[model samples]
Target: MIDVLYFAWVRERIGIPRETVTSEAATVMDLVDELRAREERYALAFADLSSLRVALDQELTEFDTPLEGVREVAFFPPMTGG
Candidate 1:
């Protein structure tokens, strides 16, 4: 199982802060496809991948990044610098 965390509007849209997912996805994008197929809320939250940022094990990564042995994945909106 992989820990999936949603932050900011991602959490708001999905109505949850985090979840444990048992998946067969080999990449982050594949995992997204699974989630998007689960419900409308997930689809909406992940509709525009360009508007989102992802992290693998707390380190920023691309959606195509491999999920092998990954324990955590986080999704959030892009951060703004002040």
Candidate 2:
């Protein structure tokens, strides 16, 4: 199982903070496809991935990054320095 964490507006749209899921996805993009297919909430939350950033095991990674050996993943809006 992987720990999926949603931050900022991703959580607001999805209405959840985090979840643990078992998936057959091999990469972050694959996982995204799965989530996008789950329901409207997921689809809406992931609709514009370009505005989002991802992390794997707490380290920033690309959407195509493999999920192998990854225990955690986080999704959030692009952070801006104030």
Q: How does each model score on TM-score? A: 0.99, 0.98
Error of 1 at 28 (Å): 0.2
Candidate 2 stretches with Cα past 4 Å from truth are none
TM-score for candidate 1, please give it.
0.99
lDDT of 1 at 67: 99
| CA error at residue 78 for candidate 1, angstroms | 0.5
lDDT of 2 by residue, 1-82 (tens): 9999999999999899999989999999999999999999999999999999999999999999999999999999999998
How many angstroms is residue 13 displaced in model 1 relative to the true structure, after the best TM-score fit? 0.3
* Candidate 1 lowest-lDDT run of ten: 63-72
> Which residue pairs collide, candidate 2?
none
- lDDT against the true structure, per candidate, is 0.99, 0.96
Q: Looking at model 2, which ten-residue stretch has the lowest summed lDDT?
A: 13-22
